[model samples]
Target chain A: MTTPTSRTRLSPQARRAQLLELGARLFATRSVEEISIDVLAEEAGVSRGLLYHYFGSKQDFRLAVIRHAVEHLVEQTAPPAEGEPLERLLTSLGVYVDYVLDNLTLYRSLVRAAAGGTDELRALHDEGRFALTDRIFREDAQGEILTDTPQARLVVRGWSAMAEEMVLTWADDPSVMTRDELLSVLALSLPALVDLT
Target chain B: MTTPTSRTRLSPQARRAQLLELGARLFATRSVEEISIDVLAEEAGVSRGLLYHYFGSKQDFRLAVIRHAVEHLVEQTAPPAEGEPLERLLTSLGVYVDYVLDNLTLYRSLVRAAAGGTDELRALHDEGRFALTDRIFREDAQGEILTDTPQARLVVRGWSAMAEEMVLTWADDPSVMTRDELLSVLALSLPALVDLT
Candidate 1:
């Protein structure tokens, strides 16, 4: 019998949040398919019954954990509202690149999970992508660099896909380029695709 | 009840190829999961047993049809090895964009199937993507425009994703840009990201 030192008493909501964070962190190292309710419960020092009570099923638990991570990621990459549009865009891209690189394992696992194409998981991934795209349109509209038209949105969205590919490839093996080179290429890529001169 | 005019007097290999072409065409309008062997046989003026004999199973049939389409796509978009690199890239991109636009229904279905991420299907998609990217490096290296570095390959691959996104979105609704405009934007985008200036 040992004390639940890490998971010491918390309200149910707090405990659930803590468990999701733990799951997200663990998912970085362990695949979602590999980490079942038993593993999660054991890792969090909770009973399997309590986890089922919180999430209802393994599928539900996986979705919730990914949802939590996506929300945190979206929140983390929000553009600062007070800077010049270009500067703000660069700042956000810098953070986005660094976040993905820093947690490359989690990011790669997340893509593999989404690529596995579980319907709810894929939907969650698309929703997160759209949310970040929306944020770019809304937050980075302070200058002429970004416009609010559907065409502009399409260009930016396409650039998002490009940057994602570059960052993911670079993060997979950083020796392909230096971090600063990768960041500069990404920063230049959007305006270039949009042909903003 | 009808005469098997199209199915008459063919070798077994030819019949299988015909059915695969039929499957690929139908997949343009129907999801891979939705079409059944009975329907294929009915449409092909053959028996379900023959279709099964040729394909072994529905999964095998799906992979073959997708593999056929992807191979055709890679071939259709190949750059000319005899032209100026810039002209060659633009011409290949024009063909590439036109191919996607003309085959919008098939292209969308193909992506959805790939996104569904069946193991062989996803691997086939990646193989096709890498094939196209490699073709660009080999065919476009005649001039000083494209260097054959890992970093350069990374840039072109990222541009491939960018162009794919842009073309798919625009093809979904071409009102986004004129074909010439989309072609120009895509052509300019690669050099821009590669920092050719």
Candidate 2:
């Protein structure tokens, strides 16, 4: 929804990405209550009307930021290939740790939004975690480590929750464990959480 | 720090509890930025200065509300005795689920505060979860079920994180699973994660 002005013309995709990046920075520093479309527009070098045209409202913009952040994490933690399922799982965990470290502020804001009970944010959070869980379960099934009684789904859900919280904790205290070591241990231990016997 | 007149009227503990209760309700309904000290004082039926006297600042008041909420949850989830470690663990999970269902808005606000990254709020969140994890580990050790290793700590940490996120997800989707059923399955599968052989 970019208005192709003679002075300032950019592709729609580029403009949207710009807005999301700026908005994510603002959200990281302040509460959602402190952010407004007017401020975002001013910061993004666009008109207030243009901001609305692009994002609809502040809530919509916040939702967009959450989506962008989640997508970024998902891309970083893409499933590994050509290894033991446990080794691949450890690689994914390493990706996750790196992602959190690189985007600490954005990740914290995303967690706040997810835990805040807004329907939009909740759906976005669930979608990202559920996709990861599905991947994990598929890998576990391939390894003959899953049961047929829906227990695998529960364990995956539990692992997703665990990873999310663990990353947050790691952000607070990076010295607790090195990223590689934590990921390796998690990789080694996950098989036990499944029916590896 | 109540004035002489206010001191004559109410006991210190009752007044503190009352303020925290009202603060929780106010924080749940409105954005934290929108709730001023004066507004909170008026809502809680106290003078602005008196509220400050009791809490020192808005941040302190928010921390008090968080601590109060956690303490209440702990009271609800008193550990079960005379049972196997897994059985007791399941009982604790059931208590946690029921508490969350009964106090959804409050729980959401607490989670939001935890994820907000304020130092005080983060400490409060960690203290509560760690207390529960320590108790669980103690019970498992006494029952000769838990391994003594850094791995045990990771399992405890992972379980703590999983429990927090699961409560958040279940709060959004009440029909996902019955509280008792989820806890029972968790109890059965938890050993795999903890090396509680």
Candidate 3:
């Protein structure tokens, strides 16, 4: 019997992971709404039934892709534990800037999603935000720059919003400022924001 | 003959303004989606026909109310022309914080609207944002705290986002920080954000 699409010899788990990676890759450049099951299955060389078997539904597939991207952003931008506090923050921020640039379209979608995405998508976005905060609190646990206080937490949360806006604006138009200039504004502004508080 | 709703002996323009004012007042406490024409007519003591006559459909009424709120916010937050640069920024921020506090529900609605409001409502929000930048640029025209460059415009734009997030967070939970404490954090942040760049 001739198969209509390529069927890899991977395990079910590996196949699922591979499909999600493909979904994420597609989602990065375009919007989730535009990603069709037929297209995804065609791109992944899988049957439509297999895509459904893995993801349950189209919405489920989109959420998984978004979740994957959020996890990647959190994992990629984490600061090394042993570095100087300032260096760690800036280093993570640099990775973050690069991450957003690589996922520029997703960033735009995220802004829209944060404003009006589904409750599921919004909850995912919230998890991503808290992941950043938790990452910072880990450094704060070392008693380096930030102290673990409610006020500090608020500042960090607000600063995340600030950084997101700055990065988004810069990414939308890099001609407005050099990447380094944007990075400096972000890295320094956190300390500057916390100073008054 | 007695009118079922309260109809004042006012001119057409005056009555229209009065209806819009009542709409704005109700919208502040609740949401646009929840504000029915029947309830509004009852609240303002105007006939349903008159409400429609003044503001067309329900959607038109909703947009007008949102636009009214945006205009009031922009008009109320503009800084005085003759003041120290830092003082002007702080005073405007102070008023802004109070404005958000007084209109907390609308502010919450605005955040949602910004994320997923109709194009018309989003454009109104954009107008309010630009109005702040224009207010600052008016001062920048005198060669004050900012030089009128594209970079400066971007900075101001991002700073407004930063300030909005900060205010929203604090307003959501005033127990996190006292009012003045929040104000200080906001006022110090812009200069600090600009210092590095």
Which stretches of model 2 miss by more than 4 angstroms? A1-9, A25-53, A80-88, A137-151, A171-180, A185-197, B1-10, B18-60, B80-91, B137-151, B168-181, B188-191
Please give the CA lDDT of all the candidate structures: 0.79, 0.71, 0.77
lDDT of 3 by residue, A145-173 (tens): 77778888788888888788778878878
lDDT accuracy of residue B21 in candidate 2: 78
Q: Write the per-residue lDDT of candidate 1 for residues A19-89, one digit (tens) a residue.
A: 89888888898866787788887777778899999999998998899899999888898888786776777
Winner of 2 and 3 under DockQ: 3
What stretches of model 3 exceed 4 Å from their correct place?
A: A1-6, A22-62, A140-142, B1-62, B118-121, B140-144
State the weakest 10-residue window (summed lDDT) of model 3 chain A: A1-10
Worst 10 residues of 1 chain B by lDDT: B1-10
Every candidate's CA RMSD? 3.7, 5.6, 4.2
Considering the true interface contacts (CA pairs under 8 Å between chains A and B), give the fraction that model 3 also has. Answer: 0.70
**Model 3 chain B, poorest ten-residue lDDT window?**
B1-10
Against the hidden reference, what TM-scores do the models get? 0.83, 0.74, 0.82
Candidate order (DockQ): 3, 1, 2
Tens-place lDDT per residue, model 3, B1-197, is: 23432745888887877777788777767655678778788887778998899889988988887777788788898887777887887888889999998878767776666556666877777788889877777775765667677777777777787778778878878998998888777776766666667
Error of 1 at A95 (Å): 2.5
Model 1: DockQ score: 0.46
lDDT of 3: 0.77
Model 3 CAPRI quality: medium
Task: Indicate whether candidate 1 or candidate 3 has the larger lDDT.
Answer: 1
